[model samples]
Target: MTIACILVILPFCLALAAFSDLFTMTIPNRISAILLAAFIVVAPLAGFGMGEISLHIAAAAVVFVVCFCLFAASVMGGGDAKLLTASAVWFGLDASLVDFLVYVSIFGGLLTLAVLLLRRQENAILASGIPVPQLLLTAKKIPYGIAIAMGGFAAYPSSPLMEAAFRATFVTTA
Candidate 1:
């Protein structure tokens, strides 16, 4: 049951964040809070040692610091920073963390380009009677939460928590 919850919650939260950002241009604080809180509760139950948990916390801290700087510089949104930090906790200090960051950067660039292109076609879209979300059409900000969520999903299968869950499932089945 715990393993199921752990597996479900991460992707569920990521989906929520992505959808919210896509439609509303905001990733709710509650989504980030839930992610952080769930990881704290679930990691130990999934067989993470104290040292591993500490490293996860450290990963989050490092991400938070970098994201905070980006936020301060107005290069990233506050909600995006929080979401990225929370997601980092799941990856911990591992190669998966690097993969997550790389995926996010790549996805972010792609998303930005797509949004920019879409914005350029806003007038044509409106003239064609297609309803588009005002946030997507008019907002100068890119919904970076989409990229973060994508990165989380891309990296999640290789995360320690997911590996533990898989091992537990295999052990039970065997």
Candidate 2:
């Protein structure tokens, strides 16, 4: 039951952040809060040891510091920083964290290019009958939460927390 809840919560929150950013160009603070709170509550229940949990917290702290600097410089939005930090907690200080960062950077760059191209064609899109979100067409900021969410989902399957959950669910006594 706990594993099921853990699996559901993280993906659900990631999806929410992506969709919210797609529609509004903003990731609600509540989504980041839920992610951080859920990690705090579920990591232990999922049988993570103190050392592992501490590593996860450390990873989140490092991510938060870097993201905070980015936000301070106006290179990224505050909500994107919070979401990235919270999501980093699941990866811990391991190869998975590196994977998440790499995926985020790649996806973020691709998303930026796509958005820039779309913005270049905004007039044609507006003239067409197809409807698009106004924020997507007009906002100068890229909806980076979508890229972050994509990176989160991409890295989640290999994350320590998910590995622990898989073991708890599948490992059985003979």
Candidate 3:
């Protein structure tokens, strides 16, 4: 069950947010809400001590503050902020958290460049009917949720929750 949570829930939420943002330029609030709620429930069952859970909460709180500031500055969308904060809880305050953020930054930069290129060729793309998400070419903002999801995926394997869940699910008792 823990394994399923680690594997299925997070990935599903990320993918949904990514696709939604890709199409609509907005991530539904429910995805972030579900992520934080599921982590709160599953972290304990996965054997995270109170101290560890507190750190995870603390990590999310810190991310919330930063994301809030970014949103306030109009540097990021509110949905992106919420989703990033929720995702941070899975990594807690550790190297995996850093890795997740790093991957987000890297993917964000690449995604930005790609979006700019796509927008530049928007007229040709529309003429060719290459079947890209319309918002991808028309929207002024980048769908940052895609980068967040990509980062979540890249860093998920090393997250403490997954590391422990893996041990619980796969390590032989003998």
Which candidate leads in lDDT?
Answer: 3
lDDT of 1 by residue, 77-149 (tens): 9999999999999999999999999999999999999999999999999899887788899998999999998
Residue pairs whose backbone atoms clash in candidate 2:
none
Off by over 4 Å in 1: none
TM for every model, in the order presented, reads 0.98, 0.97, 0.97
Please report how far candidate 2 places residue 13 from its true position, in Å: 0.5
- How many collisions per candidate? 0, 0, 0
Error of 2 at 133 (Å): 0.6
Q: Give the residue spans of candidate 3 off by over 4 A.
A: 172-174
Question: How far out, in Å, is residue 17 in model 3?
Answer: 0.3
- Which has the higher lDDT value, candidate number 2 or candidate number 3? 3
Residue-by-residue lDDT tens digits, candidate 3, 11-112: 899999999999999999999999999999999988999999999999999999999999999999999999999999999999999999999999999999
Residue 93 miss distance in model 3 (angstroms): 0.3
- Sort by lDDT, best first: 3, 1, 2
Using alpha carbons, what is the TM-score of model 2? 0.97
- Please rank every candidate by TM-score, starting with the best: 1, 3, 2
lDDT of 2 by residue, 64-170 (tens): 99999999999999999999999999899999999999999999999999999988999999999568898998988999999999998899999988898888878
Off by over 4 Å in 2: none
- For residue 10, model 2's alpha carbon misses the true position, in angstroms, by 1.2
